[model samples]
Target: MQTTAKNALVSELRERIQHLEGGAVRSRTVLPFGVPAIDSVLPSGGLAYGALHEVAGGGSGTVDGAAAALFVAGIAARTKGKIVWCLTRPDLFFPALAQVGLRADRVVFVESDREEDVLANMLEALSYGGLGAVVGELVRLPMTASRRLQLAAEKTGTIGLAVRRWRRQTEAHDFGQPTASTTRWRVSVMPSEELPVPGVGRGRWLLELMRSRAGECAEFLVGACDDKGRIDISTRAGDRQDQTSRSVHSG
Candidate 1:
C-alpha cells in the first residue's frame, strides 16, 4: 500500500490536503528579512518567493539542523499563504514550530520515510505554485536535481526552500558541492544573552550567508527569532556594519 504523509498528521491540520494545478503565473515577489542590514546584502533585496534557496546547519548534529529548520520556519511563517513541509523525519515538533510563530493552521505536514519520495513531493509542491512556500528536508542535493527544482520554482513563482541535512559529520562535506540554488546559508546556534538579574535572554545565532548569486558572502551575529518570527539585529547592527566595511572586497 502507498503511504501519504498528509493522512498521518494530527487532527489540527489533517484536512488541509488539496489539489493544485501546475504553471500558474504568480507575482515574483520577495520575502525580505526587513532589516536593512540583511536585505541590503541580497541581490534581490529579499528572498525571492519564486526561487530555490538552500539552508544547512553549521554542524552535522541534530540540534544544529533543527536550528536550520527553525530558520526556514521563521521565513515561511512570515508569508501570507499556506505552506507545505516535506520531511523524511517525523520528529518535527509542533510546539517548537508554534513557538516560532508558525501556527498549525498555516502548514500542511507531509511526512515520508523515503528521501526520494520527499524530493519528488517537493518538486510537485513547488510546481503547483499555490502555497507561500514549499520546504523539503534533504540530506543530499545533486546539481541536476537542484536545477530541476530551480526551474520548477521559476516557472510557477513559488518559494522553494531546501533544508540540507546530514546524519553524520562526514556527509556534511557534500554541502560544498555545486548546486543551482540561488542562495545558500549556514545557521549555527550561539549562546543566549545573560541577563543582569540571572535570567535567560533571547537565543543568539551565527547566521552565515555562505553563497549568493549577486550578493556578498558575510556572517552575522544576531538575536534569534522572536514570537512575531523576526530576527533582531538591533543589538549588533553597528558592529556588523563595521565588519562589512572592513571586509568589503571589490569583485
Candidate 2:
C-alpha cells in the first residue's frame, strides 16, 4: 500500500511537470544549495520554479525555524544576483545566516508588522524575476495567500519559500499551511543518535515531506551541514562503528 501511494504521488507530480513543460514555462533559473543532498532532492536540481514551498513547525522554537530560513537563503545565496527577504519577525539573525553561506550584501531585508504586507512584498519581488529568490516568514501561512504566491513564482520563475513561525501547538499544526506550493515540508530537530565516543554525537533531523508536486512523500534522516556547508554521510558509519566498540567494552 505504501508503494502504491508513492507511485501515485510520483504520477501526479509528473503530470504537473508535463503541464509546465508543454507550455514552454521554464523556471528561468535554478537555485542550488551548497549541500548536494538537498539539491538532489529538489526538481531541476534545486527547488521547483514557479511554485510556493513551505516550512512549518509543530512548536515554538528557533532552531528548526532558523535552519529552514538558512536552507532557503542558502539556495538564493548561490544564485547569480541579490535576493529579497521579507519578514514579519524582527529578530532574524543576519550573522547566523551569513555563517550558513548567505551573502550579506546580496540580501535585502524588509521588516513588516503584518503578514499581509510581507506576503505582498514577496509577491512583488518574485514577479520581477531579476532577483535570485524571494523568502518570507509569518506566524500563519494561509492557503489562499500561498496560492497567489505560487502563481507569481510560476510567472517569474523565482524560488519562493514561506516559513511558518512557531506559535501555539494547535496553530503550529494547522496555521495557514501552504496549498499551491510545489512542495510542503516539516523540519524538526531529532535527538542526536549516539556515537561511540562519549563526547561525539551524530546529528539527525525529522524531515517530513507533506506534499510534493514532482515526487512522492518520503522521509529520511537529513544529516547536519558541516562548517564548510557540506553534508557528510560517511561520518555516520564511523559513529556506528564506535558505538559497537563501546557496547563490547561495556559487556
Candidate 3:
C-alpha cells in the first residue's frame, strides 16, 4: 500500500509540472517582482513579460536617478538571459549595480550619442529576442517611439525597460504623456531603516506603480534588492498614504 501511494504522488507531481510547461496554468507570461504587496496590484500578480515598461526618477537629481537605475537593475537581475543596457551616459557604477543583483558580466552596454539612437538600439535588441531584458535610458520618449518599442517586445516576448532621465524638471514633465507601455513606475529614495547598532541599514524606496494595463495603481515602500536581487515589502514601513498621495496620473 505504501509503494502504491508513493507512485501516485510522483505521477501527480509530474502532471503538475507538465501543466505548467504547457502554459495551461497562466494565460499571460509574467515575472513576479517578488513583493506580494506590489505583485497583488498587477493583473497577473507580477510584471508582464513581452511588454514595455517605463521607470523614471521621482525628481531631477543624482539621488533620484540612482534610485531609478537601481530599480531597473533589480528587475534585470531576475531575468533569464543576457541583459542589453543601452544608454547615452557612461557614469553607471558597476559595483552599485552588482549590489542590487545585476552582475557586470551579464550586461552588455551599448552606447550611443543621441537619445534617439538609444531608443533605436533598445528596439533592435528587443526584436532579436532571447535576451533576458533590454534597457534604455532616455530623456524624452515620444508616444510613437514607445509604440514601436512595445511592438518589438510583444513580437519576441522580450522585456523592455525604459528608464527616463531628464536634466531639467521641465523635461521630466513629459513623462505625463501617454505611451504604449504596459506599466509605468516611479522610484524615489527613502530613508533606510534605523538599526539598533547605529550603522547603515537596508536601502529603501518609495515605489509607485503608476500605471498598469488591467490592474489598479498602487504604491509600495519596499526594501532594496538583496544579494539575490529579490525585493520584499517592508513590514515596518507599511503602505501608508491616501489614494491621492499615491496616485500618479501618467496618461
Candidate 4:
C-alpha cells in the first residue's frame, strides 16, 4: 500500500510540473517601462522575470523628481494582477499612485519601520507567488537580509524593484546597490519640452540605463508618465524625424 501511494504522489508531482511549464500556469510579464526606446534595450520588453532592478534618485536638482515609486506603480498598472508595495516612507500618497493607473484596490501597501523588516516582508510576498511584482524602497545602507529576498524572488520568478532614496554618494552602500541587481537605473526630471499645444507641455526624464545583464549602455530622454500611466513618444518621434532629415540632407 505504501509503495502504491508513493507512485501516485510522484505522478501528481509530474503533472503539476507540466502544468507550470506548459503555459497552463499564467506566464509572468512586466509593463513596458512606458518608454519605447527604453523598452527595446530590455531583454524581455521590460524588466525580466526573476531579477532585481534598481532605481536611484538625485539628479536634475530634485530629490524624487520623476518619482521612482510612481514609475513602479505605472508598471504595475500594466501588469495583469495585484502588486505588493513595501516601503519605509509613510507619505506614499496613494492618490498619486492612482493617477498613474495603479488602482487602490489591487495594491497591498505595507509600511515598514525598519529596512530589514521591509525586505523580509517583500520576500515573503514574492514567495507567495500571488503578486504580479514586488517593490521595496531602500533608504539606508545595505543589509545581509536582502539576499533572502533576492533568492526567494529568483525561485518564484518575481520581478523585484528596489528604489534607492537617500543619496547618490552613499547609494553604493545600499542593500540593492554595488551591481547586485540585474538592472540598475537612475531617473531624474529634465526641463519639460513645449509641445505643439500652447501652455501644454510634456516632461522629460533622463533615464540612465546604467546596468543590464545582456544589453550595452543605451540612454534616451523618455516622456514623462501621463495621467494614464502611459508615455507618448511624440518627442522621440521628432528626434527620429530630425535624424532622418539630417541623413537625407547629407546624402
lDDT of 2 by residue, 1-251 (tens): 99999999999999999987854547634545434544555556656666678876532343348656655555566566677889877777878677656767888998888878998998898888877778888766667887888888888767788887764555565644336778776666656767667874645555555666665554445564443333333344433332112111100
lDDT of 4 by residue, 78-150 (tens): 6666788888776678788888888889888888888778878887887887577888887652535556666
Candidate 1: worst 10 consecutive residues by lDDT? 18-27
Q: Scored by Cα lDDT, where does model 2 land? A: 0.65
Order the candidates by lDDT, highest first: 3, 1, 4, 2
**TM-score per candidate, in order?**
0.83, 0.71, 0.84, 0.74
- How does residue 103 of candidate 4 score in lDDT? 81
As a whole number from 0 to 100, the lDDT of residue 5 in candidate 2 is 100
Q: Model 3 residue 53 lDDT?
A: 95
**Across residues 1-90, which tens digit of lDDT does each residue of candidate 3 receive?**
999999999999999898766543333789998766678778788988889999998843433478888889999999989999999888
lDDT of each: 0.80, 0.65, 0.84, 0.66
lDDT of 1 by residue, 146-196 (tens): 999999998778889999887778788899998999888888887777766
TM-score of 3: 0.84
Residue 211 miss distance in model 4 (angstroms)? 0.6
